[model samples]
Target: MPSIAYILSAIGIAAGITFILRLIPFGIKSILKDNKLIADLAAWIPMGAILILGVYVMAEIDYSSTTTALPYLIAAVVTVLVHSWRKNIALSLLIGTATCVVLANWVF
Candidate 1:
């Protein structure tokens, strides 16, 4: 029942909104880059997130069963060691996840 022009107008409105939304971050990025407090917060936030995630994961482990917790402990250790030694996040995460998966499936 809708006219062709109505459908085209709706599509054009959606496309325009999407384009503007995509441009907003780039528009604000230059302003944020010059802000020292924002820069510090941005730098600290990822480390904070990692710490929170680590605490959450550790808290979920069952201490009563060594087998249940061993893989996670091992993986965490491996991840920390790799990251410390190589300073490569992607490599550390990949190795850590693989270690956990292998240990859980085969050793644990």
Candidate 2:
């Protein structure tokens, strides 16, 4: 049986290997700048990945509880609407976080 230290070391090695594998595309991209499509994709991939991750996080909210995530959903929607109207990201985030906190603590 592997000890905790061994398990941790294995995980570290695996993570390093994964990071190196992921870096291959970046290195290749630097060398392949002549290809317009590949260059565009390489540039957009990171931003697209972040957008997808954000959407996934928002979409994966648990709606059944009607307690924690529901408030967050409400707050997020309000925040987005407010930000759209006011163009204030900081205010929107603050409002959303405050709304969530308040709703979460509110007695039903």
RMSD of each: 1.5, 6.8
Q: What is residue 68's positional error in candidate 2, in angstroms?
A: 2.8
Give the range of the ten consecutive residues with the poorest summed lDDT in model 2: 46-55
Per-residue CA lDDT of model 1 for 39-96, tens digit only, reads 8999899889888988999899897999989999999999999999999878988999
In angstroms, the error of model 1 at 74 is 0.7
Tens digits of per-residue lDDT for model 2, 13-75: 999999999999889876787988887998899668856865896888787787757887887
- lDDT leader: 1
Q: Give the alpha-carbon lDDT of every model.
A: 0.93, 0.81
With a 3 Å backbone cut-off (N, CA, C), the pairs that clash in candidate 1 are none
lDDT of 1 at 51: 83
Error of 1 at 88 (Å): 1.8
